[model samples]
Target: MDTVTHALIGLVLYKSIQTENLSRESKRALLFTAVAGSEIPDIDVVSQLWDRGGEYLMWHRGITHSVFLVPLWALLLAALSWLFWRIFDKRIFWLGMLAVFVHITADIFNPWGTGYWEPFSEMRVAIGTVPIIDLVVWALILAGFLLARFGKKPAHLVFRAVACLIVLQFASQTVQGLAIKESAMSRYDQVVLAADFQPGTYKVIGKKGGQVDIVRTSLWAEPVLLHQLTSAEEADLQPLFEQNPEARTLAKWAPMVVVEDTPQRLAIYDPRFFDRGGSFLFESMEK
Candidate 1:
């Protein structure tokens, strides 16, 4: 998810807490815990500033976003809250854990996944059932914000309702995406699904050997063929990797890539990001 969405999720969490009897200082402390915990995992993004080996892609959502680090982050946020406000409520610790957990879980569902179980596993858990900036989620949270600003109901109740709706939306989208994948299982040796920005729409990528088919479809509609790609699985990519550092990093990061080999150059790009002309992750080396 984007940074703004992550921050908004923290704000929603802060509003959902029952702080009716808490002192002003305690409430402020909880808010700090919620927002800080939600954003702390992304601090690994700073690695790009000092990265000279083209490893920024692997380091950004690496160990810092690990499930093992969640408790450590919560503990740090709780300690900071105590130091800043002198309010030592246990809710501060628990709220920090919840905020950090939500951030990790949300990113797992996005196409740009995080290292959910790092150290134990190196797999990128990208379900691709949710877009990074989901309009439905945005609308639900924005509606909750408006209701809290103007409605007669308590802000906590409104945000709680919004949270439930967001969960329902996520569940519905996941089920549909899984169903689409199941429908294509027999046709392709490997399949990947990417959810469109609009609800109920998806791009189903099916790969068999060197052939790949990208189809745009929905739950109730016929699949529309978008682009058919071919990968040179037998091509020698070592020279490309030797000359292009980004190609080396991309080959390690992407689940699969489409290769283009010609007399002038050897180029490769991730099929997942291919649209219109080409993908930004595309790299080539001249002969």
Candidate 2:
């Protein structure tokens, strides 16, 4: 889910929780909290990519996306938001929770997963069904926002629209996941996707050459066969490394082209979303 989806989701949740019982001020404050909370979880990306480089290793997709941050951020913001909220409604607390959950939920759908249960399992879970910027969901949210803003639509209609978008995205993801699985099977008879990141990206475990081949997808990443760890490849890589160890190092971070029989095979292992060509032997992951 993108910012629009999350923000609209927060608005919908806030509206439902405080349907009819609201002083003008509490209602106003919840709206503020609604929008802010909806956008806040992505603040973790700031700690990851903004100041630092895009490297996922550089404090990216880390604790900020962790489960701990849910309570940590909710508590931190609740007091401040509560002060501004004149109407005392406990429903506001759920609104805060909705905002936080929306952020984390959206995070999981991205290529660089939100590390949802971080500090518990350092897993990067992705649905890979919905493209992060899903047009259908966006159109629905944008229409809902516009409707509420100008049309003065009923709050119930606003809430239903957002829910419909969420459900639509969920359905899309499910279909996409199945499609990828079917496609993976098409390429290899005994293919197994160990982990799928987002929008058709995955970490694949394929049974080939009487062994398990671990295939990783690069950022903006497309899948490629890196190397089969055979005795021949092992022997070849050693001397190759002895000549230019830098190639191995470069391959660790991004794609490296190795031509054979006038055709080339690429190797990629870095966590970048897309490659911006650097001098190292590896090619950029993007098209």
Q: Among all windows of ten consecutive residues in candidate 2, which has the lowest summed lDDT? A: 254-263
Model 1 residue runs over 4 Å out of place are: none
Model 1: weakest 10-residue lDDT segment is 272-281
What would the per-residue lDDT of candidate 2 be over residues 227-246, giving only the tens digit for each residue? Answer: 34321222234433444444
Predicted candidate 1 versus true structure: per-residue lDDT over 16-112, tens digit per residue: 9888998999999999988887888999989989988877777878888899988999999989988898888888889999999999998888777
TM-score of 2: 0.62
Cα lDDT for residue 259, model 1?
86
The local distance difference test score of each candidate is 0.88, 0.55
How many pairs of residues collide in model 2?
A: 5
